[model samples]
Target: MPFSVPPYRLSQAIRDKCKRLHVFVQAFTLPSCWYPHRIRILAPHPVRNKCGNAVRIKTPKTGSAVPTLADVARHANVSTATVSRCLNSPDQVVGETRKRVLKAVQDLGYAPNFSARALAAKRTKTIGAVIPTMDNSIFARGIQAFQEELGRHGFTLLIASSAYREDLEEEQIRTLAARGADALLLIGYHRNRAVYDMLTARNLPVLVAWAYHADAPQMSIGFDNVTAMAGLARLAIGKGHRRLGFISAPGATNDRARDRVAGVRRAMREAGLRDTDLSLVETQYGIETGEAAFREIMTSATPPTVVLCGNDVLAVGALRAAKEMGLRVPQDVSITGFDDIELAMLAEPPLTTVHVPHREMGRRAAGMLVQILTGQGRPDNVELKTDIRIRQTLGPPPPER
Candidate 1:
């Protein structure tokens, strides 16, 4: 009896079998009661069984028709093992044979299965990086440089953003590990102890970037946030701005933010300023948040002479707010920011900020991870320097108010 099934419903195996048998299968609606809708198998010459029902054919299962390493080997007239070596370790194969295999690969559009290759080599040659946020350009340049460096070393980078949430960051780290990341680059040293334990159990090499401490247990390649911010704060104080207002991101889960606040406080204490002199407003990192924080600080009974922002994003926000409030920068109230990102210079009055070597940090971070992974040597914690860029936005307090 004929069976009714759509042409597309037929598996590839059946199609290949029909192609080999020189038969074509088509679906058609039949008026016969025995077969209302049936697939008609047509051959060069019609042949029927005793009951006149089309004979059912069976074909052995086979792999997908997509080109494989074996197909490339066959086309290049080389052994499968030789094809594998040519694709993976090209230097292992002779120049002439390598050229031939590569040609076959291109002609057949053959793509090696990376999953299978990774399984065989016991390495993925892939690195995963988890950052605090991707909403801003703060980490953009650094990550781009890191990726370029990784590419130069014949590795790939996979990035995930945690939106500054510790729990989500932990989840992404575990997911990356489960996905067989050969290594990982984390933003900071602060995380659940279980995260470190899991990495140790997996024997994964982990590198911490963005913030650094000499006594940290994990390998770190970054600047000291406290020292960098302290240097900037001291510069503002030296300019004769006694009253300082700081707008910072929440420091509860952010070591960088916490250190920056500490740095400001240290600078104020050294400058003989009272605790009441500095007014701090903690908020998320964004232009609008910075603007709102600045407005809040300015409305206080005794607002600061200068507003020190956690990063350029917040600083830019403060600048925008100052403009709308008819406040002249450095005249009405001075403002400063960290992370001399491009926005700092582009501000109405170029921002006076701390210039972090973002690209160098990223490139060096990648090199450090590669070194540890390849067993070249374990690197020491690197403390890069941050310089203060004095622009138009920061100066002496406005003529004693």
Candidate 2:
């Protein structure tokens, strides 16, 4: 009797040898009992033993072997420094040399390691933006414009959503900062002082957007929310809407919502109407929530003649709820919304709302951030303007009924 290698161990041994030699066993079989055996060897080719079944082997993969700067330089027959200059400062290199270097980069599928570059350059050339939500189109247009402008300046945008939670926004701010964002774009100046202190400690340039206050401590780029909403409220009041109803987002957490509510009160005071003349409801921002809030306001003992909403989403919801309640818009009860989003225009009867320059605000915000990052003097706070879009929804109270 002779000792024999176990089938599993023998197979593993063959596999190990095959990997080292870059070849594989095509087909093989082991003896059923303990016996001495011999395996025929093949170099650089598939090896088969007794069985017809081929034991297939795969060639080793080189996919993880990333092409580096030196690889690009060698492929282009240039120095690594020349390759770096070509990528970072292409204008400094001659046209022909630049073309050759770029071609080699394309051919070798070489991508510069941005992590190393950011480490050496001490700037990631990236901006982080945190908004309240992404579930609606309210911030969509502005963010798109912001990203486009940043791309033109060779910087990338990293966006995160806080879902309207201040705690989450603070976490996102720290996370973005830790990940090396060169600058930041925050929605409002309502966050905790600790967050601002952290940004200051890190020396990160920040620009506040979506709400503008002349006396805000931080640099900001946005319209005056209070004034804009006040202008809209005045128009509604001028139309003789003495008995007013307002559907709004929670004012405590959001400066924009709070300021808009202040604007309505300002208009009410200007018109000599007591605060009791206006009915108010605060809810989350959504079409359904708007509908529910509208129904609640209208079912009161003294219902308003005109319902003013915080934004277009809530206004559209109110428009639907009003129709359900058999109330004719402007004739029976009027409705007005803020933010002039696309839904405002597409409402059953186009919404009477305030038109904000969302795209312009976004672009200018990016420009201001870039200016600060590039060591240009910090730009002054910008105040964009808003207009009132009077559509079919707003009108005088119904015949004093």
Candidate 3:
């Protein structure tokens, strides 16, 4: 039996066409040494005559084709374990043997699995901090010092800012803890109960800073806001400033501001003046807010001779406003502030403010937290001193006019 072509199909014509196509393809066929299945259909190859023969070719042997660690051990005259130790813990092997195995590894470019080493060590050597806000230089400066101190001890610091929201701060704290932070640093004593509970439940060491109260529930490392502010108020009164105005943070929930206002009232009472003689304006902590608060006091029937600000930031605003109003600072209007930030000295008349030891506080806080983490001691209350930086902004009243 023989194959037959249908109508309109010629057997001789089909056979001739197939023979021509085979020649066209054979001209571009890969070398016999090349893996035919691995080559793309459209891949280019050396051209050849119709003779069926392999082309002389060479290809680089990549990792998938080459011998691995086991082969390296066999070639090095050592066990696989000895080969791995030479690649990793070289000090554990004899010097001469280590050199031989290392030479074999170098020749083969064998890389040990780093994941295995990391799993064995089980330490990231990192610390975590959550602060109220980085926008304010207070936290930024303090956190910078904290990180520098941590770096000195060969530890890395991871920081997150909550922008003064308690909920966000707590969530960030949890996130850092979950990511394997050995210790945590927080700002201020006031946080949600659940945050404290979370840390307690995890047995995590936590340190609070910024504002300090002797009997706070958590460990704290800071200063007495009331005593520091009150001392300044008493000093201002002693300098013959009978009419005093206080520019402070809204006392609604800020204990530090509330205590500062209390200090001013206490000083006024001690000077045989009615508490009414002291006018207090609660405002946000900003230069603009300080200016507005100062203006409000100035427009009063009994304008104050001395104005005390919650912090140096507000004092600057008050000073700028006084200058704009054609008033001479410390002469027409004496001003004092807390937290002698760098901006205090940069003012036209340097600010007479309390110098909060920001860097020292941060360093001390880190130390206390480290102590707690290492079981050296439990959390304790710490109160660092706040000294007065007497500059040109504070002076006696203008002849009691």
Report, for every candidate in turn, its global Cα lDDT versus the true structure. 0.86, 0.86, 0.78
Clashing pairs in 1: none
- For model 2, residues 344-366, the per-residue Cα lDDT tens digits are 88998999999999999899898
In candidate 1, what are the lDDT values of residues 1-401, reduced to their tens digit? 33266545667676555444433231232223231122234222242334555544334345668898889999999999999787655667899999999999999999988888898989898999999999777699999999988876767899999999999999999999999999999998889999999999999999999988989989888899999999988988998988899999999999999999999999989999888898999999999999999999999999899999999999999999999999999899999999988899899899999999999999999999888877798888898888999899988888753
Candidate 1, residue 106: how far the Cα is off, in Å: 4.2
Residue 375 of model 2 has an lDDT of 87
Which residue pairs collide, candidate 3? none
RMSD of each: 8.9, 10.1, 12.4
TM-score of 1: 0.79
User: In candidate 2, which residue pairs clash?
Assistant: 26-54, 26-55
Error of 1 at 70 (Å): 7.1
What is candidate 3's lDDT per residue for 1-401, written digit by digit as tens? 12353323535565455445444655576544343332222223442345755333335445464547787888789999888666544567898888888788788777755455446755445689987666567777787888776665545689998765667877899999888787888876666788889888987777877888877877788888888888999999899888899999877546667878887887778789897888889988889999999999998999999999998888999999999999998889899988887898899898999988889887777777666655698866788998889999989999854
Runs of candidate 1 exceeding 4 Å displacement? 1-106
